[model samples]
Target chain A: MVGLLDYFRSAAGAQKGSASVAKERLQILVAHDRAARGRPSYLPKLEQEILAVIRKYVEVDTDAVSVTYEQEESHEILELNIVLPESSARS
Target chain B: MVGLLDYFRSAAGAQKGSASVAKERLQILVAHDRAARGRPSYLPKLEQEILAVIRKYVEVDTDAVSVTYEQEESHEILELNIVLPESSARS
Candidate 1:
């Protein structure tokens, strides 16, 4: 088997180090896995529906609305953020 | 400004709903931002150096080794996982 160092030096080109790349990939995979596995599948749907209802009253960027869950020990917190458009904010 | 629902129905084509896609992308971005912002810049480099040293003794897939820091309130946990090749395990 090729040693890790040899693989690094040869296959990896020993370039400045791809550790940041690996970390980035790992972070993404971990977050997706955590979200997909830990939350009820309906959460995202519920958020969308909530966004739908909220739209009836406000003119805003769709991307400005969000819903998320935060876990802390045995407690779970649901968080929402919405950014109003400048026209609405001004008025 | 586009109301959220109109934007969703038109821009998003009201296609089955891309809430899941948005959630997935959000999760990835959150993880990356958290990792990049919370940690010192040197952590990834240190992990690579440690991986280099470990390679001297074992034949293993480079990807099999990992280092991560987990947060729990004020406490920080550094975690490492390494899987050795079957040949090395047998010997």
Candidate 2:
């Protein structure tokens, strides 16, 4: 009887652990999806325009420029990263 | 002997499954960390200035605005979300 009880107890514990793990994974995935869906409609156009302006000054691949906008507790941030070809490689 | 072999097989399979799961979680966490670390240093200042400008026009709590920046395969996205208090509540 004790052996059976031990088996059941271990099984329940394992089930609970798996359930919590699944819940955590789901929460993280949902948060990522929500953030993706909340992106502004104008963002693509803005990125394109910015890329165009950068291309005017230097030759760069379309994928070389990255722009990120982040919001913090107190404010909003606009971060732009442009990966230009190495100068030595340009020659 | 057959039962013992079956037990070993199941144990090995479980170990393999957990190892893969751990590896996948680590990869996702590492990617998130890398993206966060790549953020520009000027982002905080930019966010502060933007908040100040917005505050000039409307009163809002510090957490009412959220910004997210994402880099996609072909382009980068800058997303901004702002939550304003209901006008009805103002009266």
Candidate 3:
């Protein structure tokens, strides 16, 4: 009887696993659609320009600058983040 | 007269400045509308969860983590950036 119950539990777990897989696939599809439809044309150039501007002031890796554009319901936020390396000059 | 020409030039400059100002206002309005319409409900929670997960291993400032969600043509990118403080242990 224990063996039989274990088999049923395994079957239910497998079903739940497949349901999660389907959900993941659907999310990917929706994300792809949104990407194709709504991305701004200026984003890449804007990021590059921002990186260049920051480079004028500090020595940083190419990856140290990040620019993100997010659209919100009442406003769009263009966020720029720069990670500066700790200066050895500081005691 | 040079003064008369200067006055006309100033008038033209004012008009141009006002045109740029109007453009800025329109951009702000459009941003507001987009912000109001389409931000994902899960974004803030997702950011907080990510920050918590990272904090378990490393000590970091609250502002040191940035989460950005960007949709592209073929994929959606959820970017998490963490600025780690320079470890004094490192030579």
> Model 1: residues >4 Å from true position, as ranges?
A1-91, B1-41, B71-75, B89-91
Worst 10 residues of 1 chain A by lDDT: A24-33
- Collision count for each candidate, in order: 0, 3, 11
Question: Which lDDT value does model 1 have at A18?
Answer: 43
Q: How far is each candidate from the true structure, as Cα RMSD in Å?
A: 19.7, 19.9, 23.8
Task: Show the colliding residue pairs in model 2.
Answer: A70-B67, A71-B67, A76-B47
Single out the weakest 10-residue window by summed lDDT for candidate 2 chain A. Answer: A24-33
> Which one is best on DockQ?
1
- Candidate 2 has a TM-score of 0.24
Q: How high a TM-score does candidate 3 get?
A: 0.25
Q: Mind giving the per-residue lDDT tens digits that candidate 1 earns over B60-80?
A: 476665555544221222334
- Cα deviation at B71, candidate 1, in Å, is 4.2
Please, what are the lDDT tens digits per residue for candidate 1 over residues A1-91? 1122222123223323544543221111101112223334333433444344434434547666555554422222233455544333211
**Residue B83 miss distance in model 1 (angstroms):** 1.0
Every candidate's DockQ is 0.07, 0.04, 0.02
What are the models' TM-scores?
0.24, 0.24, 0.25
Residues B4-86, candidate 3, lDDT per residue (tens digit)?
22232233344443332221110100000011223333333334543443344345566665544544222233444444454
Per-residue alpha-carbon lDDT of candidate 3 for residues A1-91, written as tens digits (9 for 90 to 100):
0122223223334444343222111010000001122333333343454344334434456565444455432223344444445330112
lDDT for position A76 in model 2: 27
